[model samples]
Target: MTQGLDIEQMLAQHIARLKASLQQASGEGSGPEEGSDAWLLLNAFVENDPQNWHTLLANFEQSGHWLAEQGGKLDVRIVALQRYIDALVAELKQILSEQPLLLVETVERLHLLQSESIQALTRGYQSVTDQCLRDKDMFSQQLEHRLLALQRINGVSNSAMDLDQTLEITAQAIAEELQVDLCSIFFYDDMQRVLTLRATNGPRPLGGMHFTQRIGEGYSGWVAEKGQSLLVHDVMASPNFASEVQAYSSDYHGLMSLPIIFFGDAERLIGVISVLSQEPRDFTREEISFVEIVAGIIAINVENGRLYEQTDEQLRRKVHELATIHRVSSVIASTLNLDEVLQMITTQAVHLSGAERSCIFELDPDRRRLHVLAHYGLNANLVGQLYINVGQCCAGRTVQTGRPSMAVDCFHTDEHCFIRSDPFISSEIHSVLCVPLKVKDKILGCLCVYSSHRHLLSAEQMQLVNLFANESAIAIENARLYEETRRGLELKSVLLRELHHRVKNNLANVAGILSLQRRRSKSSDVRHILAESVNRVQGLAATHDLLAHEDVSEARVDEVARKIVGVASTNLVPPEKHITFKVEPCGIVIPSRAVTILALIINEMVSNAIKHGLAGQSVGRVIVRGREEDGWVYVQVSDNGTGPAFNLQFGENSESSSEGLGLSLIKNLAGDLEGQFSLRREHDLTSQNGTNTTGDGPAEYTVAEVRFPLVRRSRTRE
Candidate 1:
């Protein structure tokens, strides 16, 4: 009886120790302090009964729950653990009070057993407490790791990386913390049956074991099939576990598997994570829960990785589209060859869309058939050989509908069905998108893209294709416009050349007729008249020479003055006569009408200067000066020899003075230039001088200054 009492005392003390440990582990200090006498007495009671620990833990959990209840929602699991410890304390106290007393010798033995039991209980409690804290620490670290993995998988800091490098990092993290021989991830193919190895960490080359296994065939496959986590205490005990393939080695023992489910609009089963260990180890709830969270994060990361890759691919394709558009525009601008332009469009379409095949189909003028103007990925012999009826293939429908058309499954479409004559059926075109190349109502051609997978075209992709096709059509039209302009310029050049030739010949003929009249004339006056006529014709011929050589349709006023003065002086008058002919340096271009009028003005003025102004003198000076002021041409011809003097009355009528024919002609030509004319004598002309010089000379010197204005013509024929 004394032994029982001693055992009860020891058990009570042990129970107190266990309760104290639980309080410390649970971070509680309200009920009992860890090193107090009550704690020691509780430990003594627990030492007599191993069941005391369970009761203690239950009581601790209940007290914790009551304490947590005031704080609203709280950790129920923690409270349960704390309550179990509190019950343990109560049970030990009850056992201590009811037990009988023991003998002194028996008491000693009981004390020894009580001490052993207390030590064992203390170790067990401490182990569980430490494990709980460790699990929490591990979960925190795992969450941080998942965040970092997601960041890496997003390619936040890098442009791209190898899949193996990404997989290795993920697998190694799971293996190292779990103390597992191997950790691997397997993904189901589109069929959802075959599993492909994605990530693994363990022995060498184990990651390389990528055998296709069915979803329900092995441990990892079973987890995926169930869409839940599984634990195998021993791989040999599992019914569905395939040791031959999944076993990292013959010594492999324990295994755990979790299915990776991605959370999104489409909650897909991405893959399965498997952990294998060399020793059979019972997995705790924390371990199982940790793996499940890790798998979920991994699923999200993988989906993010795939989306990132797709975004990068789309960016590259957009850049290529811009580059291709610029290239085609440049090609069109540089050349007028229709075939070359078509070929460029086809080749760039293939490269930009990453299509296996590409072709440009131009609509026949009558819209009856589509002609294969250019093609890439087709044999040379079949390039132009392929044509379809207007309402036949995808290209034809695009033209007929005047809208973009896309066939997700070209081989299966009811309308715009596939043509059997398509060469190179090596890769069946699962998708076909086409855009009509139309300008206003004219359908020039259709630009098409082909892909190997069905439903591959997105709205944005269709828009890009349509934009490219529009660019192609614009390029073709630009080429046509360029060709037309070039041909027009060539024709204009030919016409101008012929016009210059005919003008020169006609002037020469007039000069020849004048020469014939000059030779056949009898009287001196007749001879002079014919000679002047011949000289005028020759002046026109020289004007034509300058016009043809200088490559201009109009005559230069300054150059015409020089040529006419030069030709008239040599032919119209005697060579022995000395004359100074001078003209201003400023140039003015005159059209055909002004050319003739200005020539006549210069001709009459210069001729008058030579004939009448230098009448009785061998040496004479003639100056021709012209300037434009207020749109009027002021022309002057002066001489220093004898002719009209200051006393001479100027008459405007041609019939009044036969000597006024030259003056009359000058006045008429000036009127033709839309100008007012006035003839004036030079300053040195005979004014009221001191004395009259010699015998009545023909007259003093003469000077003719004429003003002519440029007038613009209106469309109204007046």
Candidate 2:
């Protein structure tokens, strides 16, 4: 017995050391802080027979269960327990070192305990996880039920506005669809925990169609209290679930009650729904599901009706918002002048956003800085002078991120819109709202609004501002494009005028060179050829001269015809012959390409009439007439001198007459004009295959006429 007492003392000391080690590892003080979970766990192992291994293990069964219930890191606590076991085994080995057999047995028992403890820990962890999965499935089931309820409500659209009318309709529909003798709808007041009958179908209840009672008083109230469905196939014979049969009547015997629950953060007992039969009936799983779905639908519809009644002010505010945005779009679209449109946008920004001041900054070409294009409520001087670098000020930050931003007590206090320093345009300007102006993916600029007082700007107002900003960005882009196009057109006009002047000068220089060569030549044939070349060159110069003076693209045909006639009279008409020239250009103009060719043709025609027709005449009459007929421009040069060798029909010139280089040139030029040329006598009347007969009559007058299809045209006046 003395030896036994000594062994018990040794065991107690060993147990005490084990407990102390566990407590230290678990970060607990040694002064019996038994309130902690680790200490409680230690006590579970300690409050057992110290010498009897089986008894101690029996008390500490499922060590992992204890740890799991303690509710801390399972792996960490298991590690601590492992360390304690190691230490306890070493101490026990030292305490029983003299008894080799006992020492081996004690070590075996400790090893067995560790193994059992590890297995128990695994099992307990799995058990906790299984319980969590079960809870998740239960939540999913509740969610599915609520969704089915919502679907049922969706099917029952066109509900009445009045809650009483809506409940009556629901009760009638459920009764007819389910073929029940009685269907009752109960409305619940969560705060009062009371159930009130609102509507019923079929026979009336003992309490009548509308009655109120505490939540747990009757069958419907009992469903409200329990928050569960209760089905009584035989209401009178059922045990203890309900205080009394609901709607007690001879017409109905079977009863089924369901809680009208709103499954939100927590299940809320909204009301109850009941269905009854004339005979005893058992509710099937599918039938109960259907009824529960209908009950959920009733709960949602009632709640939504209440919500609908409370949102009149919100709907009114929404209408006002639509009008405001409409006003903004109209105001922004009113102008295409970039500067004026910016001004309008800034002004509208101030009005729509309720801000004290607003400004719009345009992103510069290099994308380094923003130049203020327009401003409102702020100093007008800042409009063109203010500049902010990208990522510098509130607007700059918006540009950097290409997003909408707002700051209360901005510039410094607010981190999102803060800059390195403040411009301090106004002491009243405490809040800022900045939004980026985006067109597709390109960031054109940013718009910034300032308020004098510090106040939180609602997201709705910010969104309103953003909407305007997008429209304003498009307006600005369109205006900028217009400005660019206008400038481009002006520049192009200047360039075209310059080109015509240069061409005129070049043609005049060529004419001057030809005139000099004519003076240097001794041969009369070369001189005559050079003189005609000078006249032709000068004719083209005349047309360009007219085009250069006017901003018009083509030259007046009358002007061109008169210029060529003057050149021909000055250089081609014989000195001895008293010659007269007249040009009648009946109000017409030709485009530049056609004008050049027409000038050369007229020069050749007049030269031919002078050199061949009026070769020996002492006094002569020459006339040039232009007219439009049958979609053709006709220029006729007439003279009393002899006609050319060619007749009205090409290659039909009488062999008796001579065909010179002048007449041949005229024929080729007419072809270039896509036209026809004719040499005919004034007295020749009859036409034979468009040719005149070689009569003894040398015609009294000669007429050289050319006709071309009129393709190009310009202003009739120069």
Candidate 3:
């Protein structure tokens, strides 16, 4: 019995030390206090038997009631003590029944042990209350730190312009705020299905390191692929931590990878933010929540920066395009030559479009082929040999459809492939921009720009090229018209010079024939008739002389009429008659054929008026007037002198009452013109006030008028 009692004492002491050690580890208290209910219950159980069990159990119940009253509720430490007391009572009852002698000797010590058990219970409850207060304070501090880090992250995200810089700043902030060893940001490349390490701040001393991982292959990639957050306490033990991450950095023991999901219905996963710790750590709920919030902020800022870059680039391109258009417009406006204009267009296209070479293809309508008219930055031989059938290649297709076409990365793409198989050139061209040169609905040709490097032209660049193509078409058409006009003018000038030469030679022959006739005649009347005929021929020759000096395609009727009237007046009008010859200004121009006929008609009329009407007068006035009105040309020759009162002749077959050669010639010439001839008496010329009369007492005057349809050989002249 004595040995058994000693064993129980040793066991009770070991149990008390174990409880105290557990309480200290749990941050409760070092041990139960003296005189507490927990200390009393422990001592009574260690020393008492079944006779004292009932009393000890009663004392334990009373101590639990007192702790509940003092501590407000049943704490974990009090509950554990109550369970221990119930087990102690059951053991003590078993000992009394099995070993009656052992309980008989320990029963007298129960009163002393009860006080120590109650003291232990009270101390355990107090330790539990203090631990609860410490935990609450720690949680509050963690929450406050998380909120401050979130504010700093938001500030960095909102003010950053550059995406890479923003990412670096975000990574550094996260690492410093969370007290992490490493913070890495991985951007997901959707096309490649990979995550590229974009930014990182860590102790590994990575310098100029580029790392990428396929989705579902590594720690960061798995988060992006799954679109979930993963908290790995022990990277080596976690099955999700891939071997690649193990190989990348063996220094990290803890990892938290969260997917950066964009805010949308699809919730697109853009990337992953990984926070790593050098020592093993179980991340708190607050830390994980903070990381997720920062990831959302980083995703939004990245997308915004990308959109800003795109918009800014578009604006810059627009400015450049406008300037290019202005320059091309200046070039188009300054020139009328076709070749020079095409050359300028090709050069500007290559420079402005960032193309390696450019060519302007002109369509041959008859051949139905596109021929290179001008080119820049290409082999001369190749350009000379380059031609494509309509609807065959890039340029040809643009012409056939009258729309723009582009081939990006032509070497790899089969659709709308560029012409790289040509034998004349071995240059590897990768992209092409072909725009049709169209005016109205007519496609003149196509302008093609090529690049040796593979790249796609933006919509703005494409639109600018199309606009330039339209301008080029207009300029080309204008040049073509100018060339045609110049050629026509040159041909017309040659014909007019030839006609004048022939007319001069023919008039000289006629004058020679009249001179011969005049010299052979014996009678004075015959000689006078031959001389008058020679004067008519000389009048016609003088009209041709005026036309030959003026480099014009046709002669003016008024100018011819003046020359003819001057010749007639000088030869036929007597100086003693004081005849003043006047010719009114006219704005009528006729072909060379019409001028000869008009000269002969005017010559006969003026000679007849001078010789017949002013034959017996000492003073006379002969006036010739030519005018065109209402599609008819009228010429009037009048003299204020006595003349024959001849009737008007209306037809070619009508005969004259007088047998004079001048009247017969005048009638025949009028018939040749398909015109009407009339003779009438004219009153003396008078001013508006009737003060400037040519002669007194209504001087007898004869007026000869010829009228003919005004014919236009070409464009009408004013």
Candidate 4:
């Protein structure tokens, strides 16, 4: 109560101060008012208290209740309470008026407190909003970076050329960019229902792509089968992701698989892109969308590469076909010898048709056996030994029936010929095709091709084989005709040689009769011409003897020269002091006409050397040397004895001995040989004394030399 009295005293002092001030200013007694702006402001402050606000608002709602409650307060007891309250109000106004700056300061302080709280709340909200914006910007930047990497990959146009390399590149890029522990691409083979690891990056296993995940069984495979993206936040926890060997030690987690689908053809899922991480990372909607775009690009490129390869293979096959046709045509156009042509055809057939071996078997006239007329792949022993009876091997059957025969697999067929039995049949021959080699209506032979595998040749290849065989049959027929023509020519030549022999013998008989007549009636001129004619006939006979004795279809130049020299030497030189003969070692061969002509030329030269050069001398030496040089044959006949003047003209008009006839014969023979003829003085011309002496003045010993070109003959006639 005494404390209450101190409150009363304080209020009285405030009221007294205000009353004294107001009386000095306006001199009016204005008490505590029923209505005032200060009172309303004070009431508003009291109403703002959350705990008492409702009760104060209720109190303010009823003015009559407040007045009735204060009506009994006019009593001294109530007057004192009211006076205390009035004094409290007057003191509150006095305090407010006396310290006007204090009132303003209190209002400003309260406003400052409210403003500080609002400012603190705003700062906190701004901080939270800023953090959210930064997170959004970071996400946007990460998306942009991912798109840039995808763009970089798309810029590589050459990747389309090779799919394996492209997949590998994409896998590696994603692994590096995403900081993934594992990245791989699996290509789905629809036919096999298996996913093959096409490309991989980061920590490749021992054998790359060794493990295969079945479609609808594992995470990647199921995603590919369903043609959708898949996210395995924890691989260990995923039901689809089973591990044979646990790669994680309970800490490793998370995996992502994206299906690579062809855009236009959505049902055809090409493959899947898989990414693995050690830590769990939530893949947002945007990230999955980006991966899908990458998958579409990959799928389209793989499809494109496959199409190109298929087209390329088809083109290659067509090129091979054209080459085979051209090769077969060339073989048909070239040769006329049947065996030679058939061998050529077999070789070309094997080469062009890509067969390992081939053969041409002809039907022997007996028709009992198929003869291997020509074989390209046969060894030396097998060439003639390889034969089969009619209705035996493929070739034999083709010949017997006059129809084509083919054994797509020789190994599968037990019907093999006895004659055709060989180690090669088991080791090398596994397939065979044979066609009849016929001329008009006759089956001449069978053309056969062999390989080391069953059905290795295709339908197109078989057609080509048939075409080539048909063309080759015509060539074979032409070769047979050529052979017949050659045999006829050879027979005619033999008959002509026999005729020559008989004619020479008849001429010899006539010469013998003429010699008897020369011994009986004897006009010297007649005898001389007759003897000369006999000598010419004898020369012809000697040529015929040589041609027959050599037993060759060709002429021998050496033999002709030696025989003519022997004949001429006997007649020209006496037995007591015969001219020493020096003949060069010879083995020169020439044509029949050239041989006869060369023999005559040698006869004349040797006769001249013995008769004139060795005359009036005993033990005289004559040398006959023949040599070939620079495509020509040179014959030199020389002697140490005296001879007729070489410089003198040697025709019927000249004063030469019977030697003129020999010289004339030599000139004619030389002309026949297509040779150059010349007569010159022998070098080192002397008597047996070895002194430099010209026994016959300017023309000591006559020497004849002839030069003729060597004509090369075809050794074997076609």
Candidate 5:
């Protein structure tokens, strides 16, 4: 419309400058059109009549108000419009140079037009701002409607380990969240082809455990059958809704059902979740999607809850089984009494096998018959009398086949376990389960437990019985082995005692023969040699006699010392010698092999003390003390007599001399004791433990001490 100026270009510039947020807030489909904002500004100049200029500005106000609100300054659009007007004026001035008055009027009108357009833009600015503010409030409300999905999931996950509780909690939470009148969870049984209402937020339409419908029979069932969601505004209007199926299901007007699908399982449907409203209601896409999400969460958590329950139950069962086995193992290890242990085994097997009465049978020596070794709840008179041939009855078959066997309805069925029907019928024995009591490859016997009622055992229960059966077999074998070993030990002890007695008698005869030779001798040297030899032989006899008396391979060191001293007093001491002997024991016990050597050592020491140390002394005292310390055994023999006339080192021996021969024997005996021997004269000899002692040693006492390693022996048992 003007020279050197494109009106549409100037309008396009201002349109590009419009606020993007304002366009976005109004939505892409809404906002200024091709002939709005800058287009309205150009309309004021495009209209020919000056009277309609304000009216055109009013039109601009209708479309350009949002632009006016966006750019409050209006500097860019105003400058563009002014430049177009200046370019138009220059062209006009050139044309109207010959008419000064008209040109002046045109300039004044252009200035007035600019002022009116600015005023129009200002009015539209304030009005559109108020409208945008109200629109902002409305848009914000829509954005806040999406629920916190994490909060919802956490609310349902609190009781997810418990399946029933999870269902109920999910139903209630979803109902409250969606603001529905009722929310119900229905579990679909593929085998039964039915949908069962397992949990509900409100009162159930039917009695609990009775609310069920075949798949595709009702609105909820249809969703499960299709594995798709269903949203019905009116439950009665639903084509799949069958009122006849359940009269109370139609109480709700609106219903929305979603298939709870296990996503991990290729979208397999697990159940159906339904929310019902008492009044007709419309569901938005957002609401439907949220409900779908809740259904999916329910599907996943339900699976987890079932798995958790199964695992927990298995763990509890394992703990119980282990505890029971431990108790049985303890009892087997605790006693060797065959009857007592068998009774305990039968009791445990009866309880474990889920039966009332139990019996343990043993294979007879002939291996053709099974006899009741121990039993619970059976006739006491029938224990040994009740016998069954191999491969005949339950217990017998178990032994014959070396496996577990069960006889069901034993009394009524063709296979009968009881020999006398009267006792079996009276006891109500209808079923019996028998398993072989075998250890390794050896079958000891069989264990039979019967129930009063017809009973069937599970595989897990049978395995438990098998475990107890193995333990019982071990017990039986252990008891038998222990009995055999005990009898063997008794026989060996008797033989040993007799051998010891015979040995003692033989030695006594030898000593008597030596005494006869000594009396028949005409030489004092021969009598002394004979006397020492007799005392040595008598000491050995005394030691063996003590072993035979105690019936053990070991004897107390003090007892051996006392016996040796008694022998020495009788053989070496004269009645007028008035020598006193005292024995003190520190409760030290040495093996029989060591005791023999110990006896010899004591005999030599005492003989030496009587013959040489206490020589020519009318009154003297001989003390034998046993002591133990730091893994060593000590035997100190002291006497208040004359000390050795000639010094004899323990390591050196002069066997040609009588006293030296005795010292040599003692040295060799100490070597056999795995010990050392020392002889000394002490001024004071007080017994360490005060077993038997005087105030002090009034004179010098000859002390002989022999020590060996101490060893503590433990009895062998299980």
Candidate 6:
């Protein structure tokens, strides 16, 4: 068996040398004509293996089984070798059929050669199997190392480290795993179509490295553009590689650039991961595939980190917005002062929005112009001087459109017409955001913020400013309403005081005229009637005086009653008659219009008590009381005198009644007050014992009481 294996090895070597010599001669164009001498040589070798071809095929199948047992990488190589052996056996059978019959001695040598060829094939299979096992072991170690690196990368990614630190960690892990001189991550900016070198791990320090390349420009950019991986063994020979992009003072011999494609869609390229070697070395297929998987993991980590940053930034912005709104709302709710509210709005807007200046312009009533109402971070001279006409500038355009207006890079454009003017021209404003102060379809004005840098306000930032503007608009409207209400109240108060003064003076003049007429009257009855009329007018005039002094829309019923009783008792009761007046403390307030009628009712009742009840008597006592209960007011006037002989019913127009016209007038006044009026006689035992009495019984008293629904004015006191 050993000798046969040696012979098979020697025959395999001879065949290989013959094939090489034929191929070399063919290349030099000095070989035999096509399919002539080369065909004969190959046919002779196959004739030596004619009889044992079936045995060789069986042995090849057994070897295939053994190769299949090795599994994994050896399976494909085993199948390909078996196909080649089967094809060679068919060709030998065809060649031997053309040779017809050979000698029996030649047939014996053919069988021996066939056995040696099968042994040689078996030896070759064993050699390939041994190499596969060694490769498999090496692959296992490489896979284990890659897994450890990936685990470390995952650990860094899962940690709370920020995006930059995580990227640095990923770069270091890739460099260590691949054993490369330099590993760099280039982040692609889709908007700019440029790849910026973000993180690097190499011999050279990573400071002052600002390498960038446009898409399809350099090795990394080309990989990104093609959305594929590239392995260049020699950087100098590669057309896409640029030496300037390499790390400083480090020799770069080879480059491997892999696209950081999003996992689900391989076409969406986000960036590139590049590994460089100091020596010219060809990358193995396994190494290339390993780097591709690492690139995918890195891509996932990068995407996760980007999303985390965006979410975290959004959360921070939302928190800041809520805090700003709370602060501004607190300031707005604290006061109704318009100027103070406007000032707080502008100051807080500028501070929160990171603006160099902010101003609020109020639209005039005509809506044709904007006037600067409040401002912060602007020169005092520029505030009032900066005005915008409607449909002319940023502030005006915002009002015209009833939407927010923005002008980024304002200095280079004519978009902001307002800033083109004198005061704003010197302000050096580059960006401006103007939001209309709108409330329920009413555009009150515009709120504007100016920045010195272009594109300073993002869309989210603009939305935040708009929210603030909405709150400011509400605060401004509230302040204006408050101011208008205050002014209206002041005007009403002044008008009310003037009206009361005029009415009091007019009533007094009428009472004075009546008094003069009473003095000039010839008949005694005429003088007496005029005097009574003058006293009634004077009572009403006294009520107006009380109202004028109080400076209110309603007068205290008790105060007005006391004043009326004093004037009536002093004027009607003669000096010869001893009449004492008693008024109870009353705490009820009634409308000013009702005061005149109330005074008249008190005057008639008191005068009637003094004139008729105490006509013949020299002494009398009158009592006046007023109070409120259950939404109703009661005023009672009573006198202890020679009581009337008849009962007085309210609403009775009887002229012959002992109370006469006073009772009729009292009944009419009660009807005007929407009240119930009654006059009755009562017996007072205490009065009878203390003073004058009628006959041997207690003195009779006349009491007049009126009960009315209390119509309270807005301004009232208990």
Candidate 2 segments whose C-alpha is farther than 4 A from its true place: 1-166, 173-182, 186-198, 202-226, 231-255, 261-271, 275-290, 296-334, 337-390, 400-412, 415-433, 438-444, 448-467, 478-718
Of 2 and 6, which scores higher on TM-score?
6
What TM-score should be assigned to candidate 1? 0.42
Which stretches of candidate 1 lie above 4 Å from their native place?
A: 1-163, 166-169, 179-182, 196-201, 204-212, 242-246, 250-252, 350-401, 404-436, 440-465, 487-718
Tens-place lDDT per residue, model 4, 633-660, is 7667777665556453332233435446
> Judged by lDDT, which candidate is best?
5
Q: Which candidate, 2 or 5, would have the higher TM-score against the true structure?
A: 5
Query: TM-score: which is higher, 5 or 6?
Result: 5
How well is each residue in 570-686 modelled by candidate 5, as lDDT tens digits?
888988889889887556777666766788788988988888788889988888888878989988888888886544445433233544766776776677566778888777677
Kindly list the per-residue Cα lDDT of model 2 for residues 573-616, writing each as its tens digit.
77788888776545666666666678778888888888888987
Q: Tell me each candidate's TM-score.
A: 0.42, 0.31, 0.42, 0.39, 0.45, 0.43
lDDT of each: 0.62, 0.67, 0.69, 0.60, 0.70, 0.69
For candidate 5, the 10 contiguous residues with the lowest summed lDDT are 16-25
Residue 260 Cα positional deviation in candidate 2, in Å, after optimal superposition: 4.0
lDDT of 5 at 109: 61
Candidate 1, overall lDDT?
0.62
Instruction: Output the better candidate (2/5) by lDDT.
Output: 5
Using TM-score, give the best candidate's number.
5
**All candidates: CA RMSD in angstroms?**
31.6, 32.9, 34.3, 34.8, 27.5, 31.9
The residue pairs found clashing in candidate 5 are none
